[model samples]
Target chain A: MKKLLIALLVSTFSFSAMADGHAEWWKKAGAPYAGTVIQGVAENTPPGQFAGEVLAKDFEKLTGIKVQLENTSWDQMYDKAIKDMEANSGIYDFVYIEQDIVYSYLDRDFLVNITQSLKDQPELVAPMVNMDDFTTFIDYFKDGSGDVFGMPMEAFVKVYLYRKDLFGAADAKSGFQKKYGYPLAPATSFAQWRDNAEFFTGYCAEKGMECWGTTVQGHTGHPASTYEFLESIGPSFGLYNWGVTDDFHSCVEGGGSLNGARAKAALTFWTSMLEFAPPESLQSTWSEVASTFAAGRAAQGWVYGENAAWIASNEEKSVVVGNVGVMQPPTAPGVMTQAAAGEGYIGYFDGGAYGIPHSSKNKEATLLWLQYIAQSEVQADWAVAGARITHYSTYDDPKVAAMDQIADGYFTLMQNTGYLYAGAPMYPFHAAGRAAIDPFTYAALAGEMSPSDALDGACEALDKVMKDLGYQN
Target chain B: MNSSKTAWLLLSPTIVILIIVGLLPFLYVLYVGFFNWMPLGKNKEMEFINFGYNYRELVFDKFFIDSVWRSIRFAIVTLALELTLGFLLALSLLSSFPLKAFFRSVHTLPLVIAPIVVGAIFKLFLVQGLGPIPFLAKELFGFKLNYMSSEAQAFWTIVVMDVWHWTPFVTLTLLAGLSALPQDPYESAKIDGANNFQIFIYITIPMLVPVLIVVIFIRMMDSLKIVDEVWMLTAGGPGYSTRFTGIHIWKEVFEKRTYGYGSAMSVLYLYITIVICWILYSVMVSRGKANEDE
Candidate 1:
């Protein structure tokens, strides 16, 4: 009996050790690391952008590993990161990611999913690994499947910024309701959103305030980044019912098809909404738009409440700093409010992720670095600096909670606004659609092509791209 | 015979560069185009059904045809406008002015600005409500010009923006050609008692024709691939009104992650550009030949 017990104990110990198929990358890359620099990709890094600065500082200090952080704008970075990995350029060690294209990368092993670490590592939890931190990450991070992608980085939910001075003035409020024949409040659906925009534009114009009713990105800008624009209204147009077919293959699944009427209607509404935008808005980017609204020219607009962090930080840059009103994307009639802000709406996955090129001799170092940043503590540090940190716990931390700015408004937006960025295996024609849509969008803004024509052209162009990409029909 | 090896050696570096940077990537594009290639597809060894499906879509896809049409129209219209304005400016510059150098340099200002920066600058001036230009339209003209809002306006803004950025390209080329003109013909015409109009028609214009044709050809090639200004300025919106072929293919390779298909589209677009270029070249050569015969 004694001999049997000894033998069993020995076998169990041996089996457990074997389960660790790879080295403890942290031990090899961080404090205990005895390797090369870890590579990381930082998309959405503007000059002096908060996330990039802190990441360069924190990742270095905490893990004691050098993170080769490549800072670039979101769209260009997305293109390069995908192209780099596709061409196998192992330039990144860690990456800034939105949920948008995460799935496709996960589905393809284009990235290393860290679910195993999540299940095994505890320090990665509490502040770092709070799965429920952001609503979309929780709902959309679908299981080990979500975990399999690089750890969630930042999440931004759509929030409304309105001219408090213009709308809140007692006379303007009552007068607006009387003129529009509706309560003067945040819009609920497509119709009200348009009415509100028109009212503001007309009022602002008459008042000679250089103000306009609403602002949305028709040009590819920040709103387009992380696919905030796609989920912003595309789903409200009935995308929830539209999805890829079962077996994760071709054909429509749940959401409406791209070629269908629902999408076309949404595209039309999108076009019509542009009528109120400022003239140069056709060329405006997200930062410029944010700056425009902050400068007190725009009366209403869809902005990520996290934007206030940028605004408040640069008071001299924004005239309306002390008076920016925050709200959520208006709901459209016949469209479920829930659909307008799905909890699982995620960012573009291609927004960022870390990968080892077949050329790298530093895979172990990269792995260790990934494990370190994936920790809750680092994520919390990120949130404090005003980035859309992926972890809920840090965002909801007592210190963060104490600060009413993000905890109350920005935090809530991240939590309850429902939309998460991740979806699909990366729409094959999304970028193509964006490119084709620019001129068509310009045309729509110009009232040259009706919204339907624009959508049809865009959709057709996208379909052609898809076909070019290898889609059968 | 003795110099054969030396000549081959002399050309080797360029040949190497052409293979590595130019011809190779293009050939690779054709090779990749045949496969249903995703940026993420190769490792998966995901077999794509291939039979010129991409080309088929390019020909038959309504979106593609529309984009091609829009892109073509945009290029043609923009070129005509830019050329007309550019030639006029060149003509004006040749006549002599107090600040000719300064004006010529200022015209190149838009060219020096990065396209993204130009996009930003124009965004301020062209967006609907706040722009000085729109304000002028509303106040001075009593017309609400939502140039950035309407599709027609938005599409034209791109044309205008391109004109701003590249009219100099045409102007500068013409100016250089004009400056290099032989003064003898115009002097002879003037001595023959020719009026300004007659002198311009017989002497000045004919001399500038070859250069104008060259300028047009160069602009055609450049316009076909004009991505940055259009991309940064409109991103191809208020709803896809001003999108171009370059924008289309770029989206395919980068945004869609459909590397194989994007490459195929690019290859086809490239082929079109090459064919168009070839035709232009042949026509120009034939025209030159006819001129020589005359």
Candidate 2:
């Protein structure tokens, strides 16, 4: 009898605690949709792992709806989700909408109009959850009519991460200075970046260190290498939107700037720097680049901010923990000014959102699940765990702010210098366009083709693909 | 029930399954092939063009043609190596040995592994810096080796990985055939004072032809549709040097959402596989007749 009484008291207290803050509204509004099992799929990244392990459980407890989040590999997730939707299989209630893929998904009408769904069912919208609270990254998932189709779960910009220890060492810095005849520091321009690449590589080689000046995401056999060139490196040199103009013209022919002098120059510069990179650079993906940098194999590289926190702080995986620094990527001369005029972005802003699929049977339940994730109280923990934050106010969370010292002020750079970054171009033929141009970019990296020839071939192919897709004549 | 009616009832389940799972999908593909089918989005509708547009697009698609040729190349190379190596291994194992059972079991290990798992294992083994292969090559040979960076390296790496994974399968099949062979012919050949090589050529090869035909057909069909192993390794990359027909069709159907065009590719791939099978069938028939004539 005493045990039963204690159990009752425990249950009552737990209920009251859950009903105190944003949880109260969720519990009340979600009651009608209780016991509905909703399924979601996402890539097996840090954020996906967090959602699968933590948020999925928390959501079930708060809403009485079972959430099954399957974290699949990058390609498999896209394949499964798209197949499920195409078949009208109703297999996935929610899917991870990558920022780059929004154009393709929207073009296909594969997503539910989440904004309209929220407005239609006002009670499902938690009080703390507001459309305005999210950063402009949410705009990536919005259609031209301004109706959002997904809830932004993670947002991060690609940034230049360098080894602070290497730069701080007196001998190393002086040695770099002696070679380059400039004060050795984080690069401010492309010329300095190249000089630093050469100097540090030569320095490390001369010293017999097991390191290179920089790691390269130049995997010749994969699309990732091509992505690095077009998104991170090309944009810095004023190549915007895959070097294609809005009117479907190549930059080289003075249509938009894709194969233009600056873009071609950027491509050449990007590929040429591979020489100073580690031997593994030719086969390195983004993950390998991060690992190489963390293992102290490279002095610097353009690392996706998603990897910044763990690489800078995780002691088990990162040898250079607490010894990393983040900065904006170096740009070509006058490119920064052009970027300021909104002509280009510094680097790719890479992240994904949880979207309700059109094939979902339990739309209301899924909406509640999305709203539960968007709550301000829940943002801080998820941000710290996933190294990504969607809400504008998440930066002010003490836990996130504390991570500043660890991530080398990555969070601060993202928020203050957010304008300089952009998500993938909103092309309807996003993946197809990528496929069309990737091989040429890859050929250039493999020394099979000159940068100019590669760009020209890529531009020609893009024109053909665009025309084939009914985008152009 | 009458005997005929009962027989029909027993086979009904299989027939129904065949119609639903097999015939329906093929017919659907044929039907969809006539239209410009975009399987998703606002333009998610099939527009009828009488199959002209899709076939024309496919015919002119250099990527698809290149992928087909690459797949054939991989098939021919791996098939030749596996058959040769497997035959040699089977012959060596035929004679009584001290650890014959242990050796036989070990040889069949690769057959049991999933292709995707093989791909993952090889990826860990071959990745330039992270993999031990490169580290060892650099330390022992005083030269760095990268298997996934260069176009040629990637193609050969996938080929080697496929051979390693599948050669054991061929060896085990041939071993089973050897075990099932009649001893009368071998004993007769031995009594005739025929050498081991002469016996193998005259008796064993002829007897194993039918089994060889089956094994060859299975491997040929599977190799033509290879995707998972190569995808996990190179993903038809480094400028499409290792791109296979299966991966190309997959990209079209799933990634590009070009349902009609992908169906056309699939149908074309099916026709090509069938034609190759027919040619192999004729060769097998000719070889069997030759053996019977002897």
Best by DockQ: 2
Off by over 4 Å in 2: A1-19, A205-209, A251-256, B1-8, B39-44, B190-193
Error of 1 at A185 (Å): 3.8
Q: Pick the candidate with the highest TM-score.
A: 2
Error of 2 at B35 (Å): 2.1
Model 1 interface CAPRI class? acceptable
Candidate 2 has an lDDT of 0.84
Every model's TM-score on chain B = 0.87, 0.92
| lDDT at B114, model 2 | 88
Give the number of colliding residue pairs in candidate 2.
5
RMSD of 2: 5.1
lDDT of each: 0.61, 0.84
In candidate 2, position B254 carries an lDDT of: 69
Model 2 per-residue lDDT tens digits across residues B51-83: 577888888889999998998898999899999
Minimum summed lDDT over a 10-residue window in model 1 chain A is located at A247-256
Any residue pairs clashing in model 2, and if so which? Answer: A108-B41, A109-B41, A243-A258, A251-A257, A251-A258
DockQ each: 0.34, 0.44
